[model samples]
Target: MIKIETPLTIDKVKCLKAGDEVLITGTMYTLRDAGHMRVIEQINKDEKLPFDMKNSIIYYVGPSPAKLGAVIGSAGPTTSYRMDEFTPALLELGLKGMIGKGARNKEVIQSMVKNTAVYFGAVGGAAALLASCIKSSEIIAYEDLGPEALRKLYVEDFPVIVVIDSLGKNIYEIEKEKYKIVE
Candidate 1:
């Protein structure tokens, strides 16, 4: 039942333990499958990334289309495991935090431990609820991709659980074991 007050940096984030709930403020960027692919291409070529990676959180999301007179439409986290291929490279670039649902791979967790990163899980099926926390959204890169566009999202008090910590502790592992129905 630990709570982490955010505007979090890598140092503060590395200290987070499993079972900690975080309230994230400041800014986050949204990038899903297409966006991740492009970033990885850039990384392989030793090209510069679109934004500062230090202490930043990347949300794995492809939001619902925006409705009329709305900042964004129903927005929520997508499955995170799909981004595993691209994540280690991004982590090497100093990317510290991720927000999404579900579990990541062994490599991703190992990279997090080596790099002192954290993974957070936002609630699933709460698209409309998640949208309320997003203050503004704009495409920062890869605009041709539509909803999969790389977006810089300004958010306040965004809620998430500390899924995996820098120390290699994972909430998903604990929860799975706790709830596993033995046959």
Candidate 2:
């Protein structure tokens, strides 16, 4: 497995390819649909985002309320397709990577290639296991959105698969083709 660090640089992302297994370490931001909308609004108003976008990664999740003495609750990836509407905009702002489950739309995939970005697939239904990788997390913006708020997270050895690479190559497409039953 390739070990990657946060604030991923263009060179680093370029080296990654679809179908590689990777472990990401360092900080990543969290945003659900509400937070995503806010990002677009912030950009339209020329307002600075809650976190710097350059070379940053965002994880799509709305973690459950933490239990006492826990840093986070069951934290799993949300479906990536839901974020497709705002993904191109985020990528244009130098967002280097994203972590979520499922396939993205064509426009979003094209944007990744144009922006030298990558998309990672976190295993679905692995919430409790994945939550352990989060060392710390805090609300960074849109707290009123509750679980849909934007958050800053410090993670270590977070496991993910390269679903889409900077070249617009896609693991989803490859796997689908491989499994196709030729009649």
Candidate 3:
């Protein structure tokens, strides 16, 4: 398994391809739909963002409240398409990677190519299992959003697969074409 560091660089992100299995280390941030909307709204207003966008990785999740003595609880990815409207702006702002489940829209995928970004797919319905990988969590912004608040997370070897690479290659599209039946 290829291990990647946080705050990914352009070269580091470009090295990855569609279908690569990766274990990410260091820090990442969480942003569900509400968090995304806030960030995008800030961008639209030309206001400062809550965090730096350069080489950033945003995981689409809204973790349940932490259980007693746990750092976080039942954290898993949400449907990525819901955040597509805000994705291109983030990518344009230098976001190098994203972690979530499901396919992205064509505009987002095309933006990934233009911006040299990648989308990683985490296993859906694996919230309980994935929580173990997040070592720590802290509310970073928009605390009023509750479960959808932005969070800074330090992760260790968090598992994900490259569903869409910087070059615009996509596993979903490739698999569909590969399995298409000839009439």
Candidate 4:
């Protein structure tokens, strides 16, 4: 499994092909619909953004509340397409990676390819399993938005499968055709 560090570049991510498993280290921020909207609003106003988008990876998630003694709640990836509206703009600002579930829209895919970014898929129903990989968690911005608030998470060997590559190769597309058993 490849281990990636933050401030990751398009060059570093571009060479990765689909079906590659990776362990992402360093800082990653979590955001979903609400957080994405706020970020977009800030961007539209030309106002300062909460966090630096350069060479960053944004995870699409709204985790469950953490129980006592836990670093975070049941943190798992949410469906990706909901954030598609805001993703392209963020990608333009140097955001190089995204982690989530399900397929992304054509626009997002196009943006990824044009920008040489990458998309990864984390298992949907594996919250506890995923949470085990997060080493630490802390709110970075938009704390008022509850779990949807942006937060920096420290991950160690956080596992993921490259679903879409910079070259526009998609494992899902190939797998779907493979499973289509034509008569």
Model 4: worst 10 consecutive residues (lDDT sum): 6-15
What tens digits encode model 2's per-residue C-alpha lDDT throughout 59-151? 999999999999999899999898899999999999999999998999999999999999999998899999999999999899999899888
lDDT of 3 by residue, 37-91 (tens): 8998899899999889999899999999998999999999999999998899899
Descending-TM-score candidate ranking: 2, 4, 3, 1
Quantify all predictions' global Cα lDDT against the true fold. 0.87, 0.94, 0.93, 0.90
lDDT minimum window of 10 residues, candidate 1: 1-10
**How many residue pairs clash in all the candidates, one count each?**
0, 0, 0, 0
Which residue segments of model 3 deviate by more than 4 Å? Answer: 179-183
Whole-model lDDT for model 1 versus the true structure?
A: 0.87
Per-residue C-alpha lDDT of model 1 across residues 1-183, encoded as one tens digit per residue: 444444457768767888788777778899999999999898789888898887788999888888887889888899999999889988887888999999899999999999899999999889899899998998899999999999999887788888899988999788889899998
lDDT of 4: 0.90
For each candidate, C-alpha RMSD in Å? 1.7, 0.9, 1.3, 1.1
Instruction: Name the top TM-score candidate.
Output: 2
lDDT score at residue 166, model 1, on the 0-100 scale: 91
Better of 1 and 4 by lDDT: 4
Model 1 CA deviation exceeding 4 Å by range = 1-7
Q: Please say which candidate is ahead in TM-score: 1 or 3.
A: 3
Tens-digit lDDT track of model 4 for 45-68: 999998899989999988898889
